[model samples]
Structure formats: C-alpha cells, structure tokens
Target: MNKYLTLLLLAAVMISCSKPSDIIEQRTFTVSLDTVQVDSKDEILFLNYFLGVSTLDPSQKFLYNLNVRENILEKINLETLSLDTLIQLEREGPNGIGSPFKIIALENGGFVFSNNYTLRYMDANRQVTKQTTLTREPYITDLLPSGKSLSVQSNGISNDGRYLAGLYETSEMSDKPEGIVWFDLENNTGKLIQTQALDFIRENNLTLELEGQIRGGFSTAVFFEPSQDKILFSPTSRNMLMIYDLAADSLITKKYDSKLTSNEQKPGEAKTITDLNEFDKLREDLLKEVTFGEWELDSKTGYRWRFSKELDRTIGEDSLIFKTVVTAIDENFELLGEAQLPQDFVFPYSFWIRDGMPYVFLNIDDELAFVRLKPNFGND
Candidate 1:
C-alpha cells in the first residue's frame, strides 16, 4: 500500500476506537411561570389544604383533587382557572369510603379510593361497586399484639390500571423481602418480590439512616412506568431511588448526589427538631393553618410536593413548596442523569408532569401561578 494511504487508515482506526466524552447531555432548565386568579370562594375553599392533582384526559386541561379534610373531590378547569365540584363522598355507613386517604378516577367514570387498609371502587352514582382488602399476610410473619399492625400505604396505580403498588413494612429485617408489593388488579392477587436496589445498598455497605430508622419514611413519590414495566419509589429523606422491574421480576436501586434546591439551609442533612413540645407550641403561636403534602407521578418524571416547615425569611411567608425533579434512566433503572428545580422558584404551589414537561400550580397571594420548565439540552 502507498505510505499516505497506510497513515490515513491508521488515523481512521484510532479515531473509531477513541471514546467520546459527550454521550449524555447535562443541561439545566430555567423556569417560566404564568399566574392566574381564582374566585374568592375557590381560594377560600382550598387555602392551606390542597390534596393532590391529576388530569382527566391526556390533554391535561382539567385537573382534579380529592380534598384533604373534606369528603369532596374537586376539579379545576385549567383554561378558566376555576374550581368546581366533581363528587361529594360519604365518610360513613355501608356505602361510605371510610376516612379516605387517596382517590383516583377511572376512565369509565368509576373511581377508586383507599381508606387505610381497604380499597373500594365506587361507581358513577357514588355507590360502592367492589372492594379489596390489603393484608399483611405472607409479608409479615411475626404476629404483633392485638393493637399493633403492619404499616401499608397505597402508592401508585399503573397508567393502564393493571397493577397497584405500595410500600409495606415487615415486622423484622430478618424477613429480607423488599418492603414493596404490586397487586395485580385483574387477578386480584398480590406478590412481593425482593428488589435488587436494596441488595445493592447492602452490598455496597451504605448507610441510609433517616428519621430515626433505616430508610424509615415512605417515599413521597411512587411512580409506575407502563412503558418500562417498572415501579419507582422515591423517599423524601433519602438520596436513593428504588425501582421494581416487573418484566425482569427484580428490584434495583439508584442513588443520586445532592442537587435539589430546598429552602432549608442544609440541602441533604436531617434537621433536628430539638424540642417537640416547643415546636408544636411555636406552630400554634405563629401558624394559622398547616397542610401536609404528598407526591404523584405519571411516568419517569414527577413533582415532589411539600410545604414550608416554617416561613421562609427571604420569601417572608409560609407557602406551599412544590417543585419539579426529573430522573433520566435506562430501561434497567440505572440512573443516567437528573435535573433540579430552579433555586429561585416561587412558592405555594402544586405540579404534575405531562409529555416531558412540568405543569406547576402555584398560589401566591391568593392567585394561582402556572410555571413550566422547557427542556434546552446542552451537550457535554
């Protein structure tokens, strides 16, 4: 071969073998917000008591909520920014959904609500159609005293409504089964699989102590990915994501670094409430109303809803602290990258994600604010 051609071929081979550092894009999204005003009655009705939000259709035009303190399911027309009644639930009697915790509307006009350990399906006429019981059997072996019972929280139902998943606490750590289960809605059965993520955490000799227990708190967010056939549970106090893959029948854990924009001075560390009594006294002294929030997700990404523990000195008011956080992962639940909320985000908000975009609902000075974070990928 000619010398020039030989050198050129060698250069080409080297170029092909060399790895490029720019594989995944690492970009930060800037937040843009639009505010809307609500009527005086609607504003008064939902003050300091927004449960959670979901959309009726894929268009996400109408957002719905089951009130935190009332047996009422409300809907907000996003286009008009108005709130109206969807249903008024009975809290007692045979037809009652007792002390309801969560409500999910089905496409067929039927609805599902969870009342502690019971899940009831209500027809369009507000009649109880079918019911299912969640038990600790097979998951919990050590029988506790009569009053003591296992802890179970209904997490998320799949988009297709095939599976319902939740977090279950066992009596002891020796059981070794993962503390999460998926209930097959069609078969009316529950199966608990040991996820690989908890195993990885143990294998790596990592410590995840939070709230006086090892991985103690229920994740504020639990997501079911029908596309990937995986369930993701994100604990509020930990820096870990637990994924249960249904197709592979395995559990995987992914951990991310500290990247959230919390108003707390320390982002990831646990805050000490030295005197519980004093804290309660202060709350009574300084606060009129307080609302505890939960998390929801449709697919891979979702919103984490929280309320300010105390008034933000800079913001100068106690507002609902809702923000957006997205996790990018392969089908195997391996973490690729994630993006944090903008640090300077306004407060008193709620949010839901649709079509890779976050729709933030905020209440500032009795007005509703809608914020969105559009993607602008920057290759690295």
Candidate 2:
C-alpha cells in the first residue's frame, strides 16, 4: 500500500464516522421531513422529535394544487390518508417557539393539536372553531378519552361539542393536584373537577411533604377512552398511564413499568419486569367500545390489542393493532426481537390491546414505516 493511499483512506474513514446524524440505515424508509420553511400566512405541521408532519392553509380552499407550494398541512399525496384542513384558528407553532408535535384528524372530520402553547380546536376550513390554553409549555402528549386520540390535542370539544379538555400544570414542587379542570367548548366554559393520582409521589419518586404533594407539572396531553367519557394521559418523563374519568369527574393513577429500549435502560433491565397491567386496563376499556376484544402483554413484546367492535367511532384501532406488533412479536405470550434501537429511532406513542398486540412508531430511525403484525405460537 502506498503511503499516499493509506493517508487518504484513513481520512475518509474518519470523516464518514464523524457525525452521528449522518449515520444511515438502509432498512428504514420513514419520511424524513426537511422543515419546509413557514411564513406569516402559511402553517407547517411537522414532527418535533421525529413527530409526524403536515401543512395546511386557508388559500388551499380557494385554489386547487395537488403540488404544494408555500403551504404546510397540504402535503399528503403518497396515499389516501386524508390531509386535514385546520380552519378558524390563527397560525401558530409548537410550544410557540418551534413547531408543535404531530397532528391528527378527529372522528367528526376536524383536526386536533396543542400549539405547544395552548390547545386548539379547528374546523376543516382552516378556522379557529374553538381554542383554549391547555398548558403553559412542554405540553403533555395526550388524546381525547374517546374519539380520535392523536398524540396532540385541541383545548375544546366534547361529544356534544360542549365540553373541552385543557392542559394544566403546576411546579413539580407545587401541591399535588386536588382538582382537575377542562375548557368547555359547547357553551365556552372552563370547568375544574377534583381528582387524584394513584400514589402520586411513590410512582413519581418525588417528595410529597405533609404540606402538599408536589406535582411535576401539568401536561396538556391526556388520553381519552373510546367512549369519550374517560381519558388516558401521561405526565412528563413517565410511561405510566393516568386514567381521568371526565363524566364521573374523578381521576385514577396507574403506573406501568416504563418501556425502555435496551439502549435507554441500564444493563439487565429487559430481564427485569416491565409493567403490563395498565395495558390490561386499557384493553378492558377499549373492549367496552369494540366488544369481545382481546389483549395479551409480554415484557419484551410490550402490549397488545385487537378490536372486535364492528364500527362505533373508527379511531383506527385496527390500524394500530397490526402496527404495534410489526416492530416485535410474541408467541403464546413469549417475547421476540431486540429492543435496542438506532440512535435516531425516536419512540412514538404506543399502547396494547389485551387479545390483540403491541404497536409503536419508531421515528428515531430516519424514515417512518408503519409495522403491521401477526404472531406465532410460543413453545412450538
């Protein structure tokens, strides 16, 4: 080998390994958004941490262009997944500093999202159908107790278009929340209901002095059951699910052992038990809407779900069931697949159905691919 050639090869190798973001995996084809710039008139809906992306504008209604130019929210041409038109609400971005998290369409054909600043309920006309401040900053990712519970949320709306679920947070050291409140969109009301979490301190590892329980903070995102009566929500940095009964005006806290990737956890974490009970409860709740549903959970496999409900809300439960397992699968409740993920494979929202399977979005990888799954029996 010539001296010149050796030096050149060494330099090439060094440059190739220099930047981690440049690392690429051939298997992943998930769309990588380039942050199509936004201006005063146009709005761009993009994934913050590998979150989903879309762009919508009012002008789209007046003029038709399959080819998007200077418009956000209007960029879904690859498939039939409808691109929602957010009307009425003024244009905004995530947490008001950057773009918000993912955007999801709703059951009645509208859209829902938190501005990272406040919750918004927009019509298909790109108008502010309704709006309220859900959280201050660092919005908690949540969904409606029922209807379309996307990762993001809007501050307004009930089944009757009257009540709205808003985000609330106090200092981690503030008093443990003794009351919960929500914005009422129908009559334009803000109602605060008393609530509590299941061992708010022990589950969180925070000090709850006799003075008051210190809350980490209020997250805008909370999960809602399919009935639109209950919500499943999480606080910051915790995988535990908090069930809020809206109609009953009560709250229950249940902690699932957080599902950490092999990379995220300390050594031997996988061998340790990961909570699957909360998933079981969610399955029971999901089944009431879907009927005769089934769910199973394995520590390595995560969670499961399959909807026996013919057609009530059509929140895309069928799509999620197959997706949860495509990443990994279990046989007869046993586990398979590696939890260690690529650095870029940022985890997205996930849950399991009891008789069904676990589903997750691996955006940490460059491209986003929806995993659909079927399982084989264990101990064959």
Candidate 3:
C-alpha cells in the first residue's frame, strides 16, 4: 500500500474507535431562573391546588390544563401568560368523557383525554370524535398476566396521535409496573413488550403496609420522545433508563454512574408501621435519600436532561434542604456533565423543555406562574 494511503486508513480507524467523551467536549451549564406570572384577566385560574395534567402545545405558544374539578379545559397563552379560553366539557350526554384525568394536546388542534378506562379523542370544537376503552380490548387482556391490568392513567399518546404507550401494573393495588404496552390507535392493534431491565423497579420498591393497606412506593417516569419516535422509562429508585424504539420495536437499557450523588437508592426493609408518626418519618427519610426526577429531552441539542435530588441538610423543625442536580447525557446515553442547582432553587411540580430550555411550573400565591431555566453551556 502507498505510505499516504496507509497513514489515512490508520487515522480513520482511530477516529472510529473514539468514545463519545472524546468526540464531544464536556460542557458545564449555569442555570438562571426567570419567573413569568400569568395574567388571569380578573378571573380566578383553577390550578387544582397542585400539579395537574397539563401540556404545552406543539408550537409552544399555548398551555392547556384539564380542570378536573370543573370538567373544563383552560387554555393559557404562553407568550402572554394570559388565560385565553375555558372550554366546558360534558359529564353526561352523547359527548361526555366522564371525568378525564389525563390530557394531551394534538398538533392539529385536537385533544386526547383519558379517564379511568376510556380514551376519548376530541376535536378543537370539544366534540368527541372517537373513544377507546382498554377494558374492552381483547388484545390488552391477553397481553397482561392472569392478575395484572392495564393502567390507562399511565398511558400517553404519540405526537402524531397515531399510537398510545403505557405500562401494565402487577395488580390494581400495586405500584409496581411490569411491562410496556404499545397500542396503535388507528389500526386497533397492540403489542406488549417485557424485559428484565424493569426488574429493578419491581424488586427495589419500598412498600409499607398498615392494616392490610399498602403505602410508600415509587413509580416510573414515562416520557414520549416524539422526535425519535420512542418511549423512555425512568424508574425513580435508580439511575437507569429504558428506551423503547417505536420504529425498530426494540427495548434498550442504559445504566449510569453518577459522581454528584448515589447511582441508586437503597431502601430499608419494608415493615408494618403501627403508628402514623413512624410511617411519616420513614416516608420522609426515603424521600431524603437520593432519587431521580423527571427526564427531559432537548431536541435542539439532542441532549437528555435528568434531574435528581438528595438531602443537603435539615433546617429547624420540619424544614428539609435538598440538593438538586441536573445531568446531561448525549444521544448515545453518555453522561456529559452534571450541574448542582443553587440551594434556594424551588423544586418544580412539573417541567417541559421548549427550544432546548426547561420551563418548570410554579404557583405564585393563587396565580399561575412558570420559572424558565436559562442554561449557559460552557467550559467554565
């Protein structure tokens, strides 16, 4: 071989063998919070007193909240932070959706609402176009084990509104989810995917029983990655992630080793709490220990962001200080950086990423507000 050609081939081989860390430079980010207050225009915004089922529109121009108490859909303008409209929904009659608990806004000005058993797809005019009940589907029944059942509240529709993804709980009373169900809304078909990767959640769950009633357990955070056409399953008890590719129909698991905190939580043995105080203490302690938060994907940067919390300290009385860390991972699931947020940072009830930045839901007094975390990624 020619000397120049041989040298070029060797260089190519070296580049191909390079790790993600070698190709992508590690970057640090400083997060600054900007609070935006909502303008309700003299009308009271029913926030449900907590983080309820809400979603930002595809264009990020509007936010929709399902007022479970009033059976109304509250549409707020994101750019203006003003309450734009409130569409009343029927509780009975032909268009009744029956107390929707989950909602998803479609790109084509429609919405999908999920109750306990039925999923109703409604048009922009608030007219029910189609309805599906998981309990009536024979395919879902066969997919579950003898005692397990489908959890409609845990399900979410795809961005294109073509499919729905959810998990199968071990039982109606159990907090542990055992399998994933991918259902096609258009074709009325479904497939159940199970893997040993989810065993950690089943085995490591901290369950406390009192008078035959179970309490104190963790649940997996499910995120639908519309850009990649995948569903990500992140268990709160561990630093592991499972990605289900919709197109390829494959499940892949990735485990992370964190330098900022513990990789996974080690819960004490489950026991019967006889006293209410004992149960409360144990629950608080479990939350104080390291636990993962929500997982968000930044489409602009192709970087996955994961939030985690650990007990920083305890103030006087019942006050607890937490150390929240945000971890950044690449497209290949490689950890690139971890940033510790300020001690005064308020934990978000819910969050979403728009244009590669995170916007967390905040409640200022009785008004709706949002704290946008502007990130500066650099070497410093």
Candidate 4:
C-alpha cells in the first residue's frame, strides 16, 4: 500500500511538471509592413520620445505627443497620417503644467501630464482641472526614510478617471522602482502596493559609474489595461510579466519559456570606469542580452503583444541594430505566437495595436512615419 501511495505521488509530480509542455503549443505568424508618413509643416521634435494614442477616441485615430523642447502637445491623426493640432503649454502660471515630461490620454478626452514630481490633469479646453503633488502625499512620504521622496510617473489611469496608477522611484538616480501607488483622484487618497516581484529589477540592473556619477541602467515599466483593470509591471532585464489586478488587489507573476530566445537574461555586474570609451564598450556588451518590452493588449483580438530584442553584434554599436522578435499571448496568458521582425525594422519606443494590427514609430529621413505590421496568425 505504501509503494502504491509513493507511485501515485510520483505520478502527480510528473503530471504537474509536464503540464506546461503539453498545454503550451508553439505558433507561427507571418508579418507584412506598411509605412505611413506624417505630413507636417515643421519637423516634429522628439516624436518618438514620449507619446500616446487617445483612449477617448473609440476608433484610436488620434496620437497625442508631447514636444518637451517646445512644450507643445501635437495631436496627429493616425487614420489620415496628418498633424491635426498643436497646443502650446505654458511653463508657469494658472494653466501651467510645469515641465511635463510624460503625457497620458484620459478617457474623457482630457490629458494627464507628469513632470516626475507632480501629476496635473488638463481638460479638453487646456485648463488644469486637477493636480496632485507626490511629495505632499502622506501615504507616499511616510513610506520613505528621512530625506528621501518619491519620484512619480503617470504609468496608468483608470477608465473612469477615478484612479491613477503611479510607478515611483526612491530617488532621481535610483534605477530600482520601490512599488506602485494607486491614487483615488476624486477622493485624494492613495494606497501603496509593494511586492517581491519587482525585486528582479534591482537584482538584474547593470550600473555604470564614472567620476562618482551613475551613468546607465535599465528601469521598470508599467502598462495599464483599462478594460480589465490590470496593471502589468515589466522589468527590462527579465522575461517575467507581473500583473496587478485592481479589482482583486492581487498580483500575479507569469514566466514563460521561449522556444526562440532565452527565458531570462543573466544579471549584470556594476562597474566603475574612468574612460568614456570603456563605458561605451560595457554598455554595448550589456545591450547584447535579451531585454523585454512592455506588454500591449489588443482590444480587437483580446491578445497581448510584447517585443523582445538582442543586439545584432554583426552591426557596429554606432549603427545599433537588434534582432527583434514579437511574441503574442492570448487572454488566458498562454503563449499564442511569435515572429521575428524584418531586419529593416528598428525597435520603437512608441508602438500600439489598432484593430489587431501593430504600428511602430518610424523616422523616414527626418520626416515622421509609422510602420504598420499586419500579422497573419495561420490558424486564425
């Protein structure tokens, strides 16, 4: 009877170990590209730096980009591929959203601007309707030790514009993110949620210090899915996806084994170099490792798409090309498909899926252009 019981336990362990292999099937996808040019009077400055598509627009037609150089909000029509309007923002005064470095489109055609210290909400008429200073928040301030404050970014805003999800760092130089804070915009209340899942970011960071100044390292990024009330915490060094459900107030971590690339990158060691050339060489070597991008959810197909890339060492570091691959996951967090992008395409800071098609920012000889990737999932 004891032998039979031992056999049953072994069978259970084997079944659990083999479940992922049996259930997760590899899929292939064919990708085609189309480039659309943006017709503009003046050259759009920092077009790819920080930009977002209008969530208020059901068709996802408008792309809102913040020109940090000019402090202007450039709204481009994605459907027509034209510059619709540019609203110049003031640096000071009543309607001023002070030195906003990040812009997020709200559900009600409004915008949330973050300057790393304060989050200001602007209405359609360009009026600053609401504002929250992160340093003043007791919930956030109390968490930190003396002489340390939180540097907040507008990571995600809720569908109804009631809650703002912020990713905060301990200091300006800190590459590690402490945790996420969910601020109730209407009530002016906040809740801090910290988890061990984000520890990988600190563990895997490759920091370069020169003359007592930290130079380079990767940071944590967050993606908010309004439809599902989920906040995805993605670290650049690892292939792990951590999802925070607002409704349930729970965090779920998902790790995948990719048949195409390495599952995770090895943690890099911190180095202090005196010469600039040595710093560049070390940075280039670090870039050759697998790094994962933010996961973007496709409303049309209910699938999530994430792009990962490793440096193509064949090309010079000056050229900076990567061997890019896009992986698709279904609604159930199961791996759906993956495809290696064409060599001509570069990894983009601005990318989104419209009608189940992926669009990436492209610069065509100083002009604004976008490359639309039409992916054909063979089974679908």
Q: Pick by lDDT: which candidate is best? A: 3
lDDT value for model 2? 0.32
Off by over 4 Å in 1: 1-30, 39-44, 53-59, 68-70, 84-86, 136-150, 159-162, 171-178, 199-229, 257-350, 354-356, 367-369, 376-380
The residue pairs that clash in candidate 1, if any, are: 195-251, 196-251, 197-253, 320-348
Clash-forming residue pairs, model 3 = none
The lDDT for every candidate, in the order shown, is: 0.46, 0.32, 0.68, 0.65
Error of 4 at 178 (Å): 5.4
Give every collision pair in model 4: none
Cα lDDT tens digits, model 1, 21-77, are 534333232333333454434445443443343434445565666655676666667
- TM per candidate comes to 0.60, 0.39, 0.81, 0.78
Please write out the lDDT profile of model 4 over residues 1-380, one tens digit for every residue. 00110000000112244555654233445666777788886755455453442232445777777776677777778778788888788868878878765566766777877766677888988899988777777765775556544444326555455666655666544445666766666776666676555655554344556777766544334454432356665666767677788789888888776655677767654344556777677666667778787787776788888888876556553676677877778787766666666666576654878878777777677677777777666666
TM-score for predicted model 2 compared with the true structure: 0.39
